[model samples]
Target chain A: MGIALILVSTLAAGVPLRLDLVLPDHARRGKAVPITLRLSNPGPEPATVYLQGRPTAFDIVITRADGTPVWRRLDRAVISSILQVRVLPPGQAIEFTERWSQQDDRGQAVPVGEYRVTGVLPTDPPSELRTQTVRLRILP
Target chain B: MRTPTPVQALAAGTLILAAACSDGNEPTAPSNETPSAAMQGANQGAPDDPIALARGVPGFGGFYLDAAGKPVVYLKSAAHRARAEQALTPFLRSQGLAPSQLRVLPGRYDWTQLEDWFSRASAGVLAIPGAVFVDANEASNRVTIGVQQGSFARIRGIVERLGIPPEAIEFQETMPVRLLATLRGRVRPVVGGLQINFPGFLCTLGFNAVRNGQRSFITNSHCTNHQGGVESTPYYQPSQNIAPARVATEVSDPVYSQSKTGCPPGYRCRFSDASRAAYTSATTSTLGRIAKTAGPNNGSITISGNFNVTAEGSASVGQVVGKVGRTTGWTAGKVTNTCVNVAVSGTNLGQLCQTLVSARSGAGDSGAPVFKGSSNVTLVGILWGGIVNPNGSSTTFVYSPMANIERELGALTTF
Candidate 1:
């Protein structure tokens, strides 16, 4: 198994951005909210990360502390996100830019307390080995 | 003038065993001492030494009886051989066997002729009688012999036709050799990290070696441009597919899909309790004990307690028990009644059964070690088959005989 490293040299204006989980720091059950992740690459090489799904090709996931999946979307949406970041190089970094709303097919918000996010990424230098788990959490 | 001497008697007995038990053609046993031997005994050297050339030839085939009387087979080969050195290479290198160890017929088209060239190879020799194809015209040509593993047993038919004495040929067993050259210092892949052998996927499987200093074990023929490496799955896949989805996709609806496949060729799926937890309790207890036992046997660290086994065991069915595996460990089992057939594979291969005192074979256990428990645990079978795919409904089981596997393994690892 490989490990992915994140180096944050500068942030909002040169202040290194902190990589942490953001969510219902404390929220009511059944409330739809978004989680944000801070990103940085302090090394000379850019990093390309992929959010690998669970069990199958179509299931990218970020589960709650209790093991319940917090990210909800049709299979198509997951595939779309995958195709979006198909390419990324070293030394480059993306911010807490992407937004995702949590809700079920019935449009009902998911019951949650704490959540985690995980996926896959290529960590080898000079090699673009793909597919990995990216794990993170949201405190609501 | 005299009864057969002790040496002659021994040679004859060896010939009989080889001829009667071989999975190949039967050859007439030669005299204990060749005609040349008599001349050498008389004059110390002979001019018409047919036995010299015949003995010089190598004997190549798979699945032979080793010195220990256990079946063995060689899993390695060499590309070059000198005519003079070919005859005695196998014996000298692996098992320290000699020309007298095997008996080949004299007249052309005899086992002696084939053995002349294949027998000697320090690296290893896979002895399987070359298949003989006899056309309508009765012109016989050599066809290839196919055994689950390369062994003499697979060539029994060929040996019989070539008139090769069976006793002379023996099986070799491979000692576990080191195979971690490529894996030694290479960067370890994360659970989902993917990297091409960007350099080269020589070989990744590692084993302990005896003779040669630990070296990477790679087969020339099994290599392709980009096909090499290890995967997270239980089955032994080519090197190219080691990553997660980028390589192998989980069988869709693994449970349902595997279950449907378990049904008969044309039958409907039937989810039965027999396929579920009938022996779960027994299995849990058995595995718990076995996992502790594995430490002494060099098993992987994490032996799962939740592995599956069959529930249907009958009394004295002489079931050829073993595991179908990628990691290549197999054992023998007996039919214990009051048992049920567990879903060994994902499909309808219900032949895989669970035993109480046996071993716990898991994912990599496809070829786990199995042995008979009737008396003491004697190595009796090889695990070769089971449902590759399994469904909650029904799983299939497939197995190869331990005798066959042992026979082949014997030939390869004798040294």
Candidate 2:
């Protein structure tokens, strides 16, 4: 009976959250590339997700084909000091689009090559939810 | 192993050679070749060069260096790309370079298309509630329209019916726009963040300005006049006594002048929510720096007499900007939109194009100076109002660019 009750409690806790990274297959060297981070809750019960950063709630990292880190979205200084939390509803998906100027952390143009772009969502309790690696090719 | 013969060693060395040898008598590559055929054709009889060729091309949008540090030309469309390539290929060959040296990329829209959209939108063809702004995004090669959530579908349909391609139009969600002003009373000195006291209202001064040789300070037009009218009310700075001390008289508040006609061709009507107050003292009286805090606040940092007025410049989307005001002392924000048309509620002011910054600005923060950089501040605009969300959180702060303000008021920021 205890095991069955635990199963029921777990079912009532709602489904696990999922995050997807959306990026273009190819982009120009100096052009701005739009990257979308989509968060979806597929369970019946709604879950509250908190965004804990100023200006933007998530972070992005772009690395070369050999896994050498190139650029990071969080490296840019935040102008607004206010931090915000956004709530996510059940069965609904929310996406935020951020643009990358194809430059590295030092504000120089990134070399033309295949790169791996990763999106990470920082949650409470010092946990991080990472998305699947998305491949991007920088064309000259 | 057996020793290799001299001939065999020579053959191996020939295969492993790192550099090739050429006879000194061989003809050398031309260092100064005549201009390409495409360049000559594009420039006609004038100076034939890449820049001149780019300018003379019919559908050329612009040129920028690519990742390989080669010049690339942006053409209006695929058809234009084809024509441009055909004209330049022969010239590239004459210069001992391949057609690929001069890259041609397809542009979503040319300069003409963007200007046409701007002119039509400013002329009220696409004017509607919820659609608060229209601006050209050069980086994305599209025209972005900011609209309220309720009016998104309607605005999208209207834009589509007007022949704007679906891919070339972007819509952003925004709150209903309103003017930043309230009924209050106070005044003080400390140019940018000081209070301006009118008859029954108070506002923050934007910046100390100079028109011709006269010294003055600028503030929101709505501060001097609630309704669409002008008033020559005496201005005062906040004082320890009950009544503030008179510092200047309102010389011009032109926000509500109906006698003026439409702006001349190629220029949109200057819908400025700014006014200039002639200083009662000498030009050296007011400091040129913005206050670190409001005058009413005890920790206000006054501008030094030696401070210089930085040059005024335009704000780009994604650029960081800072502001000092009465309510929200010193705060920094990012420019979200450069050209935004806002409709102020409860006022006869129909719509005005403003520069939108993401910051926390309240009712009393209107007319504050929005500047860029910390040590060397460059004046960008004047705080007019902001969109306060239902929960009282501000989505964005709206201000008029200094370029428009200077043209409208015939004044510039004084050092």
Candidate 3:
């Protein structure tokens, strides 16, 4: 089995799956924060989904209160040759976590402010897998 | 809580065995020994501990903590898994962590291997049309090749001939590359990314630098010596119509000058296309900041305020960097290639290692200051020139990495 399979299981097709973003309410500046995505299958049948692009399909975007994007994980250059396909059974939730270095997309220290982090699980039909916006406050 | 399966138990046992065998030449630790609290506390504060340690170990591509909080180190080949596991398990144990905390995963290429592949590709395979930049993507253990439309087939043929597996190479369609040059366009107090008039043309000011107590501003050497001849020149702010404010003492080594001819055999050779201008005291002002704008990528955006630059540093592949140049103002882009050796026509610069940014820059933007993307920016590089698409939409801006610039000029960024 490939490393992706060992890390995250694939989901079956045609089964309704919901994505949930999980993060801390408050984080300190210059600290490492982990953002996780929970993909749950609420349907009775198993669902299969392809995690296209790079090793993982999750993207984290940080934007200011006015919706101006400050940073985005997917915006950086990535190796797009490797693709992953995962299958998830009913009532099964697979989580993928990525750590943020408390810096903006440009590798600079982010100012202390209220920001919104959106976790996106890009799928074929687009908008099929998206988590609720998580509010995070950066403390000095 | 989930119980450990038989396979998991066997894996844990293997980790313990690997840890014990890591230092076979050294005396084995007594099983009854207990770790000190101070040692455990210190280990707890090891920032990104596994990844930091793995970077020093050869064949280790990358690492991340699994869902179970186990450090999984990705190795280039399964053949080296035992060696990696043995090397890392002992370190984990020394850090007061269990041997099972370390897991070895297999990857197609390691960091050094990917770098070597890119170095070769940049010199040969990447010469094909549509191939804009070649860089290593260590996070995914693959070499990313940027190509324009209609070049994928040609690039694939080269990749096959190079014997690189399809899975190890990634191709992305990008705008055609072009060098940013124009006969146009700042500051000790005057600021960076602004216009600096020199002799016949203008270029962007990079940053305030100092060497042996002498103050100066760095800019593209080509701006000081446009005809490929090394000569000192006077620089003016705003425009040459203004009073001459500084004199450039050191134009970069003439184009195609190799460091190998001067340095010993074991020393690595470097090439630079940067020059420095000494302040004339007529203008006793300097600020360690780059001009920033409010809107992102809007050419019409105005300079909002200066982005504070605390120090200078090197940039990594895939890192997002921002630049403020006279023509483009404030623009941000991802670094596509680092350590690239390319030739710039007319400038007579050849085989200089440059950092490639995926942003459009114009002719006058040469010598502009490149900074990290953040509210508090740090000096990253100095823009020299880049390839602008035929239609003039996008550009592959090339720059001299700040580390290389500092070494070549023996100057340190003051701000």
Report the lDDT tens digits of candidate 1 across residue range B116-174: 42333111223333222211100111112212323334445445545434343322222
DockQ of 1: 0.02
lDDT tens digits, residue span A1-140, model 1: 11334332232233332243333334345444454443444544444343211101222245566666455322212110011111224345443422345554345565544555442121111112222234442234
Off by over 4 Å in 2: A1-140, B1-189, B226-229, B239-243, B255-270, B282-284, B293-308
Q: Write candidate 3's Cα lDDT for A1-140 as tens digits.
A: 00111112233445567777777878888888777777787778877665433234457778888888788765532211112335677789878888888887667888998988877665431223555566788889
**Candidate 1 C-alpha RMSD relative to the actual structure:** 21.5
Listed in order, each prediction's TM-score against the native is 0.24, 0.37, 0.39
Q: Please give the ranking of all candidate structures by TM-score, highest first, separated by commas.
A: 3, 2, 1
* Count of residue pairs whose backbone atoms collide, per candidate: 135, 6, 31
Give the chain B TM-score for each candidate. Answer: 0.20, 0.48, 0.50
**Candidate 1 runs further than 4 Å off:** A1-64, A75-98, A102-105, A109-113, A120-140, B1-93, B96-104, B109-415
Candidate 2, lDDT over the whole model: 0.58
Model 3: per-residue Cα lDDT over B23-110, one tens digit each: 2222122132243444333333234355444454556665555567555666654444444444445456765666544555556567
Location of the lowest summed lDDT over 10 successive residues in candidate 1 chain B: B273-282
TM-score-superior candidate, 1 or 3: 3
lDDT of 1 at B143: 18
